[model samples]
Target: IADQDEHCKKFMEALIPEAFRKLQCSHPIDHWAGWL
Candidate 1:
C-alpha cells in the first residue's frame, strides 16, 4: 500500500506540471497565475 501510494504521488507530480502547461497554452490569460 505504501509503495502504491508513493507511485501515485510521483505520477501526480509528473502529470500536474504537464497539464498546467497545456492549460496555460490553451488559455494564456493573466488570471491563470492565480491558480498557482
Candidate 2:
C-alpha cells in the first residue's frame, strides 16, 4: 500500500504539470478564473 501510494504520488507529480499546462493553453481565461 505504501509503495502504491509512493508510485501514485510520483505519477501525479509528473502528470499534474502537463495536465495543467494543457488546461491553461486550452482555456486560459477559464482556468485563471477558476484558479483565482
Candidate 3:
C-alpha cells in the first residue's frame, strides 16, 4: 500500500505540471496564479 501511495504521488507530481501548462495555454497564468 505504501509503495502504491508513493507511485501515485510521483504520478501526480509529473501530471500536475503538464496540467498546469495546458491550463496556462488555455487561460492566463496571472488569473490562476491569483487563485493559487
Q: What are the Cα lDDT values of the candidates?
A: 0.89, 0.92, 0.91
Error of 1 at 11 (Å): 0.1
Candidate 3 accuracy as lDDT: 0.91
| Local error of candidate 1 at residue 4 (angstroms) | 0.2
How far does residue 1 in candidate 2 sit from its true spot (Å)? 0.8
Summed backbone clashes in each candidate are: 0, 0, 0
Clashing pairs for predicted structure model 2, backbone only? none
TM-score of each: 0.72, 0.67, 0.68
Ordering by lDDT:
2, 3, 1
Q: 1-36, model 3: which lDDT tens digit per residue?
A: 999999999999999999999987878766778899
The deviation in Å at residue 3 for candidate 2 is 0.5
Candidate 3 stretches with Cα past 4 Å from truth are 28-36
**Pick by lDDT: 1 or 2, better one:** 2
Of 2 and 3, the candidate ahead on lDDT is 2
Candidate 2 regions with alpha-carbon error over 4 angstroms? 28-36
